[model samples]
Target: MPDRVYLDWNATTPLRPESRAAMTAAFDLVGNPSSVHAEGRQARRVIEEARESIARVLGAAPRNVVFTSGGTEANVLALSPGLRAPAGPVERLLVSAVEHASVLAGGQFDRKELSTIPVTPSGVVDLERLRAMLAGGPPALVSVMAANNETGALQPISQVAEQVRQAGGILHVDAIQAFGKIPFNVSELGVNLATVSAHKIGGPKGVGALMLGAGIEGPAALLRGGGQERGRRAGTENVSGIAGFGAAVKAAMAALDADLARVGSLRDRLEAGLRQTTGVVVFSSDAPRLPNTTLFAAPGMKAETAVIGFDLAGIAVSSGSACSSGKVQPSHVLEAMGASSALAQGAVRLSLGWSTGPEDVDRCLEAWRKLSLSLLKRSGETELERF
Candidate 1:
């Protein structure tokens, strides 16, 4: 593990030292954040400070930030049926076909009431199809991710918000991947609700927040008991984890511009090297994408074997394909982008992070060169055997 190059930032990031320090300090305190005693007040203060930090980042009021276990819980909390916007209560849920698994689950909505809006061959949501679906629905709750995890394609959120507004619907943005990487302001985008994970930005893995825009109300408690999170979510807060999240958010935003420039440069260098391999196909190359990510594939390669090849070479990359029941399948993201099954099955993702250095990128490129060469050799041998 000493010489390993980790290029899976899209899945998770290493916890920052700043976040670790904050959590360590919080552990010294001994009181439930929901209590009213002096010791409890101290813990409550820590949680509230963390809430304010996240709220400020998302352009939301402190009272509107609801802390949850992680991004998945936050997404589930936001998709509630009782949520109310200025227009009215949402009657159905509409999510893009390319959304994360949690969003595609449709939350509390029944399958009959949920709709999947298609994306274009380039991976952007089809606006016309969305319009047609919204035209007849009664203030549907639309969930869309700000950026795709696998392809790193940035969705047209501002435009999607406008259309939802015109349709008298509410928009929920899963901004987990984009929050720390780009300038993401839920208020500026006119989204009703937005969710982000702490771990994706170098914070603790078990915490996240759901930000409610002004005038949105009652996402209806997913858990009921305590008066925590303004009664929107219950149970005592993970004070230490929230403290870590606050520190991470502060540090990430403070260094946003510089980090982005460095990480982006590394990603560009990596992608350029990757394309030097023959038959490499970089997905969503023509669309706006996250600067830190590259999803690519070549003919005659499959994700499972390539991932193993990269790992054996002292590098860490990921297959875009999801493994189900011990079987590898094509990435839904690429399939939605009109990639053939063979190409989708071969997709591999290499993502950069704040700590990704030139050496890491070079290491990944070297590993890829070896893997690609082996793939071509195997393919050629198969052709010769066929003749």
Candidate 2:
């Protein structure tokens, strides 16, 4: 087998060395964070330090950060109806049509009580539609992601926050994909709740956070028992995972600017290479997107087939969100963006990371080029074989 290039950072990033070291140190500590003994105090200190670090990175008060099992749980915790913010209690839910499967599942809300706000062809949330939905409903909890996990399309979160505020609705921004890749300030976004996952930012999986903005009360506890996380989430804390998350957050913030520039350039070069091939369409190309992501498709190409081809050519990519990659179906995100089923079925995503370099991009391009040629020949698309 040949060395493989990894271009699926959006699905989950490679763990940072800093995170690994932090986790390793945490693992050697003995004590439950809930205990009052010296060892317990040490464990608790580690958790508090991690909480403070993550809070500083997200521009939130340390007390407002509620650690969770992962992004899905963080999101679920934020969707509770009747949760109080400064405005009032939420009575319903409104989510962007292009939200992740976890968000689209209508967390904590019955199907009849949930409504969807549409997005434009560019994959941006439609403010007008959102306004109309809010107008017709009771105070709603509106959820929109900072960036699409599949296409990296950045939603109008700031604008959406304003709209939700005007409508007296609480806004929850799923920043799981955008947190370390882009500059994210929970206060600046004016969101009541923001979800972030550790693994998406180069920490280990199984740890995430729900950040509550100032003046916003934390949501009802999702898991009630031990009175952990200020009674917001109750469980024996995963000390090592939280330590890794803290380290990853610190490292990610420090290198954010450089990573953005480097990864964005790599993504551009890769996209330019793919565009040189005929019938390649870049999704959300005209919209504001995360610097490290490119979702593209070729006419007549099946995404699964293309993914397999890439793997065979010593490259790694994904057909869509890792959560839904195994399902043999068109992307719900693309469908919500008004993409034809056929085009959606063919879509593939390439997400870059801090470790991605020019050589990795070149290798991905070479593999894709060969795959395109082979597919074209089989389809007898002579006119499209120029690449």
Task: Give the Cα-based TM-score of candidate 1 against the true structure.
Answer: 0.97
Which parts of model 2 have CA positions greater than 4 angstroms off?
85-87, 321-327
lDDT per residue for candidate 2 within 37-145, as digits (tens), equals 9999999999999899988888899999999999999999888874874457787888999998889998888888898889999999999998888885568899999
Steric clash pairs (candidate 2): none
- Per-residue CA lDDT of candidate 1, range 1-387, in tens? 688889999999999999999999999999887778999999999988988988888989999999999999999999988987557888899999999999999888788889999998878999999999999668789998999999899999999999999999999999999998899998889999999999999999999899988888778899999888889888889999999999999999999999888888888898888877667888888889999989998888888999999999988889999999999888888887889998899999999998889989888887777778787577662331110
Question: Where is the poorest 10-residue window by lDDT in model 2?
Answer: 320-329
Off by over 4 Å in 1: 381-387
Instruction: List TM-score per model, in order.
Output: 0.97, 0.97
True-structure lDDT of candidate 2: 0.89
lDDT of each: 0.89, 0.89
